[model samples]
Target: MAEPLLDIHGLPGHLIRRLNQIAVAQFMEKMGEIAVDLTPVQYSALCAVKSHPGIDQASIAGLIAYDRATLGKVIDRLEAKGLVSRKVSPQDRRARVVKLTKSGQELLQQVHPVVRAAQGDILTGLDNVEQAQFIALMQKTIQIGNESSRAPQRELGETG
Candidate 1:
């Protein structure tokens, strides 16, 4: 057989990225079961708007760690689905403020249980106590990542 690529199970960052891909794929599968048909990013955008009603596109992009251009496209899709509303920001005519519409709120209410079920499926390897700890550890690690994000960074195998 050919050589394994990069020791598939070796690096923490690689494992984390693999896990993210798995999680998002699982999310898509689970959402399909519920007939929601939402991509993971769309769900995140909805949650962000739910948490910050009347927030602007740039802020939402930052909140979701999405580039503005991509998030604008996401907003366009959401608007088409009637799950989100956008209005020109009164204070900044150049900006668009976003909010979830009633349908969006209802959709969120339906999605929470589905998402929780999906989370359980994602962490089925862990017991309840381990799941809690895993979540806490993930939160801690993600915070650290956010803090270090502003500094110079390199790709996993970059020569620099």
Candidate 2:
């Protein structure tokens, strides 16, 4: 008997998608426990802005591997939350530069430990060594397949 395609247990894409869902759920649950109201993408944006203060919105999209157009909405939400501030870029008047505000920095610091702890739950069945190996493998796979993604991650200094 031919195996059913609907049985996606052995499929990498299906597995990866499931893992992503689990990761996001764990992240949101942990954040909720800590009383922090931030999505994974928003948290990534905050980290990117913190790392490269005054970076343009397009660069942030690249850094975080998020769709550039959609990132605008994400930034708007962050701005509305008073976590980040956006200003017209000095070098490019048309571009908006983003910076994490004091509140954003403080919230990030407060939630850092919670976020780190939440990582363990994402791969709950994996032990310490297995988790490290899985992470390394995932990184390598992502690096190899990055260019194939609709929103591929790019180095901060890389130009399109």
The residue-by-residue lDDT of candidate 2 on 60-106, one tens digit each, is 99999999999999999999999999999989999999999999999
80: Cα error in model 1, Å:
1.1
- C-alpha local distance difference test of each model: 0.83, 0.93
Residue 30 C-alpha lDDT in model 2? 88
Model 2: lDDT of residue 138: 90
The candidate that achieves the highest TM-score relative to the unseen native structure = 2
Of candidate 1, the 10-residue stretch with the lowest lDDT total is: 151-160
Worst 10 residues of 2 by lDDT: 2-11
Would you estimate the TM-scores of all the predictions?
A: 0.83, 0.94
Q: What is the alpha-carbon lDDT of model 2 when measured against the actual structure?
A: 0.93
Q: Best by lDDT, which number?
A: 2
**What is the C-alpha lDDT profile of model 1 across 68-153, one tens digit per residue?**
78889999999999999999999999999999999999999999788877787778789999999999998888766863553222
Question: Which regions of candidate 2 are displaced past 4 Å?
Answer: 1-5
